[model samples]
Target: MGGDHGLAVTIPAAVNLLRTHSHVFVHLVGQQVAIEQSLSRYRNLDPTRFAVVHANDVVTMDDPPAQALRGKKDSSMRVAINLVKEGVAQACVSAGNTGALMAIARFVLKTLPGIDRPAIATAMPTMHHGMSTVLDLGANVDCTAEHLLQFASMGSALVSALQGKMNPAVGLLNIGEEIIKGNDTVKQAAELLRQSNLNFYGNVEGNDIYKGTVDVVVCDGFVGNIALKASEGVAQLMSGTIRDEFQRSWFSRLCAVLAYPILRRVKRRLDHRRYNGASLLGLRGVVIKSHGSADAFAFECALVRAHDAVQNGLLEKITQAMVPLSAEADAA
Candidate 1:
């Protein structure tokens, strides 16, 4: 809650959530006025449940990494990461400064063992049915074949954890179902994926994306981000169309009422914004990136995701499985 945008909406909404969930701890990072304002709004909050830290820094979108880190030591983003590092906080969630957030997370949280680069793994609604998780979603646009494999392993493990299964049946996001297709990186990644112990479902295409044809789709950040954004845009267009159709004349309005409950359910199920936060896998701690336009509800959902990731001990499981697998491969 530190950026130029005031915390008027976020702070109150967070406060109410704290009130409902007293077990949860809320930490505020911002200027004295903003922090104090939030605390005062939740004055009756249990002293132990809610805490405030006056941060001297706020990273803007335009600020380069070097500038954000060197220029703003007291910035809220930096301070938040520091708290995570020092064990004062389990994890820090931010809605501001994507580049800055990645920089701070890398700086403070550190990468998980054997992971050279962390990737953004997020759940997306599938057109075929249910939902699927995609990884390397803009965290790394360019990656080595090995890096893509890591994303596959990481995404597979995460999806399994979420879906309650030993293996969620992974798929490599590629230009074609044929293993031989795609550029050098994906081709090599496909070879490695085929060798992995995890459930590797070979390659999938953009058209196969929402088909719910695979549990996890792995791709480089560049393509993955484009796919994610395009899917979101399409979902939004569909929502608009449905709303327009429902709002027509009296008869249509009556039909809208008849279908209101089901349509609302469908809209909620399909809303991309609801699952906006993408977990930065391969990081020591759970760090989520939500949309810049995210509202308080989205922020709250992100918080829940962070909580779930930690509770699931996702990093621990992935690392436990990967380190040994790497060893076995080396020995072979």
Candidate 2:
């Protein structure tokens, strides 16, 4: 987990979560000082569940991930991934530098058969209909048409597994919903998707994301990141506005007390912590990314996600499915 504020909270949760698993040794890889401090603080934690393997150096959020991975030999990110590569750990989770996380995962785990670059993918609630997943959120701001196509393919497969939907509707994020809209990449991506073997539901506008128009929405990181942040902003702003309105009048204040249970429920629904982690799809191994600002409960949420991915063999399934799809790449 990211060693930010709330690490105290995350540590206990991690201890309890791992206590039930057998031989779950943790390699607490990060900048040397942080890892030691963290281990020392949690000395009384479950001895049977996690043994500490320390990493001294970690890339910070400010550093460029690709460059840092090459420059630092014992980076915490690399060390964690190397442990996984060497069979030391089944999986790893981090709330630290996301760029380094992606770079190291690629360098260590490499990509699966059909994967060019592993993309960060997450499921989010939508306005139009049911919840949907979005991919390449910040993995690649400038992407090729092929990249968008790959995201759609992988995103759909993941949603099918998690949501238990067969041939889930897939949509391309576009400015306009018409078949001939969007920039060159979006237009070309639409054309390619329609020809591909995966389910394609044509183009969808940003306004339509919550309408449940598609099971998975595909876009470059730039657009996807904007869409994600915008959604989060809107949810927060709406909640704040409602809270202020309730506090303004005596009757409304009384009503708020009456609606306290309902308000709490709404807050819980919008809690990003519950949806704190996302999968880095198309890697040889499974890598789960947690929010950088994640507290201990947030980290705990991420650890649970990693455990699930490990148990379910998410990497194995993606590899099996991707092998057949990206056969030409392997052949080449």
Candidate 3:
């Protein structure tokens, strides 16, 4: 109900997931009539695996985060999250206002023990033919050294659970590989990460992200958000330029035909839709934030992510990793 196309994208994605995963159950939270109408379009849908919960209000993209939190108590976003809180659902996925989703999630699910704020963790495509998990992607603009350390722990645990990378290498995002490059907070965070039991790979420069020098990269929200948007812009620019050049002339069009298969592979490799669903880590419950403008395929990727996280016991893994940190905090 909150996304650009609302149920048009979500319902189809839900149907796809239900068809594919027999064990998965999806609770559609929105206006009953709209949901029913959407589901009616699909004749082969399994009605037993899907249920719709009515939500009277909707939190729009333009709505302020605080306003959405204070009001809109019956919004679909809120109801979906409540399902997670009530153990009726293992996770909640939404393509809605990021700020409102984060605010409401923090208020409802609360933060995990030893985590001051929840950081957004998402996989970024890398040149190494793999993905790097980067955290604090626009979740907390400012962060303390402790927060950065927490991000590293959460990210490491996430990669381990999702990617099956036990003790995955962790890197602190910095201006330089040298220890003296970044601000005091990052430098201090580096020290903490080094001392911890994680597989710290020292400071990693911006270029190292694409190099896949580490499995996990940790940064404050301000820097992580900038990096994410910049990389996305570059990908778009490159794709557009290639397309324009290919259409410039008859010869180029012929060349494009010859290179069609390779270009398709390249496009698939860099497709951001494949990497949709940013996890709001450090929360008590699983909440995935899909891009607000995501289409049906992209939204389906988000649902897959949420399902994978639940099946892999992401919450339990993060909780186990936080126990040592929580004890240390108490000792201090």
The candidate with the higher TM-score, 1 or 2, is 1
Residues 1-332, candidate 1, lDDT per residue (tens digit)? 63334476457656766765656787777777867765675446677776787886678778887788778888888887788788777767777777778887898789887677988888877774578888888888789988988888888778766666688878888877876799998899888888878798889988666787888889999999999889778877887887888787888989999988898888787776678678878877777776677777777777767666666777787787578557755787
| TM-score winner between candidates 2 and 3 | 3
lDDT of 1 at 216: 86
Residue 144 displacement in candidate 3 (angstroms)? 0.4
Ten residues in a row with the worst lDDT in model 2? 1-10
Q: Which is superior by lDDT, 1 or 3? A: 3
Query: Candidate 3, residue 50: CA error in Å?
Result: 0.7
lDDT, candidate 2, at 214: 87
Model 3, 69: alpha-carbon shift in Å? 0.5
What C-alpha lDDT values do all the predictions have? 0.78, 0.76, 0.92
Instruction: For candidate 2, list the clashing residue pairs, or say none.
Output: 10-296, 32-56, 126-210, 127-210, 127-211, 128-210, 128-211, 128-212, 129-211, 129-212
RMSD to native for every prediction? 2.5, 3.1, 1.0
Model 3, 1-332: lDDT tens digits are: 87899999999998998988889999999999989998898997777898999999899999999999999999999999999999999999999999999999999999987788899999988984898999989989989999999999999989988898899999999988998899999999999888888899999988888889999999999999999899888878988899999999999999999999999998899788998999999899999999988999999999999999989989899988888888878888
| Candidate 1 Cα deviation (angstroms), residue 38 | 2.8
Candidate 1 weakest ten by summed lDDT: 1-10
